[model samples]
Target: MNQQHPSMEVMCHVHNCKFNENDYCFAPKLEVNPLQGSGASNSKEALCTTFQPR
Candidate 1:
C-alpha cells in the first residue's frame, strides 16, 4: 500500500537565502533537486532549489 507523508512546517537556518524569515523558510513551497548527471547519490549532491541569495 502507498502512504503519503504529512505536511509540516519548514525551518530554515540559511541566513543568506531570501526566503528565510526569522529562522524559518517563508517560501510557499520548497523543492530539492539533484545536481549530478545521474541523480543525487548523496545529500551533498542535492541542492535546495528554493534558495534565493539575499
Candidate 2:
C-alpha cells in the first residue's frame, strides 16, 4: 500500500542557519521557533515552505 501524502522539497536562504548548506535546505520538516531581536518580535514561526502534496 502507498501513503496518502508524498514527499516534498523545501528551500531556505537563511545563512548561518544550522540547516543551511550550499544554499540548499535539507530540512525534512518545517519547524518554527521564537526569534529574538532583529526588529521582528514574536517571529517564531514554522512552515513547510517546500511541501508538495500529491
Candidate 3:
C-alpha cells in the first residue's frame, strides 16, 4: 500500500526500538505507552522518541 506522507517516519525507543540506519521504523503500528513518575511530565501526552520525520 501507498503511504500518505512518504517523508514521514516513526520510531519507538520506549523499550525495544526498531529503527534501522536508513531512518525507517519497522513497527507494525504506533501505540501509546503509559509513563510513570515525573520524568516526562512536561512532554506531550504521548511520547515517540524513536520517531524520525524525514
Provide the RMSD of all predictions against the true structure, rounded to 1 decimal. 3.4, 9.7, 8.2
Total backbone collisions for each predicted model: 0, 2, 1
Show model 1 residue runs off by greater than 4 Å: 1-6
- Clash pairs, model 3 backbone: 11-51
Q: State the lDDT at 41 in candidate 3.
A: 52
Off by over 4 Å in 3: 1-8, 11-16, 19-21, 37-40, 44-54
Candidate with better TM-score, 1 vs 3: 1
Candidate 3, residues 1-54, lDDT tens digits: the string is 977744447543333344443444675555444365535555564565444453
TM-score of 3: 0.30
Candidate No. with top lDDT: 1
lDDT of 1 by residue, 1-54 (tens): 899765878888999999998998988789989996759889899989999999
Candidate that beats the other on lDDT, 1 or 2, i.e. the better one:
1
Best by TM-score: 1
- lDDT, candidate 2, 1-54, per-residue tens: 886865666566676666677766666666544344333444343333343332
Ranking by lDDT: 1, 2, 3
Steric clash pairs (candidate 1) = none
